[model samples]
Target: MRCVIAGGGPAGAMLALLLARAGVEVTLLEKHADFLRDFRGDTIHPSTLRVLDEIGLAEAFHRIPHRKAYGLTLVTDTGASRLADLRGLRGGYDYIAFVPQWDFLNLLTAEAAKYPSFRLLMNAEANGLIRDGGTVRGLRYHDKDGEHELRADLTVAADGRGSTLRVAAGLAPVEMGAPMDVVWFRMPREDGDPGETFLRVSTGRLLVAINRETYWQLGYVIPKGGAERLRAAGIEELRHHVGRLLPFLAERVTLLGSFDDVSVLTVALNRLRRWYRPGFLCIGDAAHAMSPVFGVGINLAVQDAVATANLVLKHGPSAVAAVQRRRMFPTVVTQFAQRVAQKRLIAPALEGSLRLTRVPELARIPVINRLTRTFIGNGVRPEHVASR
Candidate 1:
């Protein structure tokens, strides 16, 4: 069987790799010439780590420059409270690896190249579906030369939340509202800076500080659709907020002289009622756009690819719907958790009403802590690679 997968993000790249390894011809299309996009989801949770281990890429993945975060922490005015401790997990892969997403995708593509059946077309953007009656026959894409059509037995849309192919297939994800959008930027890391990555929360402010060894990748959370208003307030306003949340970066806050230095991620939490239609299938953010609450987006996408591959190999092109059936539970569970967090924690925090100072250390409780660790570290129904 032949498959054409769109968008060489985590889902498309991985599904292509697995299918090709099993001797099926597969082509992966990437709109960009390179995977160097900044502020993309960089958290590779243990569930994905275990998948790499199963695929014999775990050691190589570790070889790349990445930081291992053992736990999640919430920093407030009172003190820092541990949220989830990944080390408590049973699997040898206990920590989330914070690797630049480009490096991670490069690793997957490189390994995929070993199989002659795998074809990766860089700068090839899949724009629409090539339909035969009701079934998707292949894809119509554009490259530097011109637009073209490629025929395959199955067409997969792993293009992401704003997926072009998903739109072409007449699929729309049910919009689950998020209370905040994120402004992502960077500042230089200096001596005496806080080492571990943590979430900083204060009255009317929520910021995420990720340690990138040489620099700090910071995400400032603001009210939904508030990017324009924040810009109106001027760059100095952002600088002041960052300095207040992370006192250590007070001096270098001026590095953000303008808003152009940052990127805004409009947070979304939504999923499709149906992830597949005939020969077409949507996976990853195409099927379910995740909230950035737990950083589980990449891992979930990877899991979807793995499950899709296993089912396709067993049931052929007819397995398209099965992929959704197997993945829907986890998608629902994860998104539900994110929505709850948004309502209880993030929404309140952004509104300057989260009583972090008065609230008990909930993470210290055994059951809630274990559940949080498992939810973040392993995810729901973590899939294993099916034997070829």
Candidate 2:
């Protein structure tokens, strides 16, 4: 079977690698000629970690030199939450690991190359679906060479939240309102790992301190479309918000440099009511896109690839029902992101008496900080990947 995957991102590449290894002909297409430095979905979830182990690519992932997370911490708007330790998983591996999105994509692309059956065609944009009745039969694509078509037994859309293929297939996504957007950038972490969670309530924000090699991914949720205004106000004004978001790290203010191309992304949480139609299936962000909380977006996408590949290899089209059933529970990753959005945005604003009692300044209290950290790793803040 010739399996053609759209989107050279992690999900598409990983799926191609798995199918190719299983003796299937694979064609992977990526629109970008090269991996861009700045991108979204940086952290790799622990569930994804377990999948890597099964696929025999865990060591290769580690070779990428990504930062391992020991635990995560959370704070109220006042920045009161201290560090919560998430290393309680039996036999060591517990906390979520941080890595640059580009590096992680490159790692998967390299691994996909080991399979002789897998062929990658970069700089190719898949424009539409070639259908046999109601089923997708192949793809219509356009590149510098104008246009062409390729046929495959199966088409997997891993193209992401804004998937053109899914849209072309007429799968209208159901959107759950995620009303917040974020500003992302990098900053130097002088000491200790950058895998801490800082949630401050008074300032109305959430911060994910992701540890990279020399810098950390510092994210802050702003009112929808605040990024344009922030940069317009200049770096000093941006720092004011950052300082308010993470008071503990306020001393490290000077170390925080450059916006690194402030990215404005709203909480895009949605799922296609139907993930598969006949011979076509959508995986990763194409099927669902979770909010940024817990870094579940990319992890869920990778998990979808593994699950879809295993199901196809095991049962072929005969297992379509099983495939649909299997994906339902994992949809909770989207639900989980929704829950975080509520905690961070809706519940806080609407919690009448609770909001009054929840002192934003009390986040600086040591015990309060400890309590916040306690809730992060096991339940809320850190990453979760559901293994197949």
Candidate 3:
């Protein structure tokens, strides 16, 4: 079978690699010339590690430079608490690996290149769907040369949250309300700084610091549609806010010299009511745009790719609906958890209510911590690479 996958993000790359390894003809199109974008989802969960292990890439993947985070710590005005202890999980790959996403993608694409059936078109952007009657048969894309069209038995949209092909195919996502947006930037890490990854929450503010060895990848959360106003407050005001929340970073907050350094990620939680059409399917963020609550978006997308490959390689194009059916439950459950956290915890914290007073006590319970870890680390129904 021949397949044309739009977008070379996690889902697209993994799906293409699996199908090609199974001897299916696959062409993967990536709009970007390279995968060196800043602050892309870098959290590699255990579920993804298991997928890599199944495909025999785990050892090589471990060679890449990355930091390991065993758990998350939450600090609030009331007190501090351990959010989830991932180390206690039964899987051998319990820790979350924080590797640069480009390194991860480059590894996948490089391995995929070893297979003759896999074709990667860098800088090629999918412009529209090629339709025969009501079914999508392929796609039309243009690169540096000119417009070109490729025909395939199946078209998979893995183009990300703002997917062009999904829109071209007339698929609309239902937005489930997100209370905040994240401003991501980097700050220097001092030797004396808090070693564990943690979120510091104060009145009207929230900050998450992910250890990147030499620096801390910071996510400053603000109310939805509040980015412009925050910019108006100036960088110094923002710096002061950071200093007030996490006193240790007060000295290095100045590293964010200007607003230009900060990237705004407008958060959204939404999914398509229908994930596929007659000859086409949408997976990953193309089907369900996830809020970056647990940093599980990438893992979930990888899971989607595995499920897609497992079904498609076995049943061909007829398995499209089965892929959706298998993945929909996990998507719904994860999104529901994220929504609840946003409503009960994050939103109120941003609105200046210290609802996190119970976190400290809750963290002491062994069963509660274990359950939280399982939910965050493993997800609902992790898929394996059955195609191999």
Q: Give the TM-score of candidate 2.
A: 0.83
Clashing pairs in 3: none
Tens digit per residue, CA lDDT, model 2, 1-388: 7788999877897788778878788899999897775747767766667667777777877887667666544555433443445554532356577777787778777877887988888899998999999878889888899998989888888888899999988887888756567677766666654344444454344455555657666766666556777777877777776777665467666564666645656677788788877778888788877777656677667766777777888877545455556775667644765677566664454332224234344335567545543433333222222222
Q: TM per model?
A: 0.98, 0.83, 0.98
Q: Tell me the tens digit of each residue's lDDT in model 1 across 1-388.
A: 9999999999888898889889999999999999999999989999999888888899999999999899888899988888777777978878889999999999999999999999999999999898889999999999999999999999999999999999999988899999999999999998899889999999889999999999999999999999999999999999999999998889999989798899999999999999988899999999999999999999999999999999999999889999999999999999999999899989999998887775456578889888888889999999989854
Looking at candidate 2, the ten consecutive residues that score lowest on lDDT are 379-388
Highest lDDT among the candidates is held by which one?
1
Rank the candidate models, highest lDDT first.
1, 3, 2
Ranking by TM-score: 1, 3, 2
Residue-level lDDT tens digits of model 3 in 156-184: 99999999999999999999999999999
Per-model lDDT: 0.93, 0.69, 0.91
Clashes of each: 0, 11, 0
Question: In model 2, how large is the Cα lDDT of residue 231?
Answer: 75
Q: After superposition, how far is residue 164 of candidate 3 from its true place, in Å?
A: 0.8
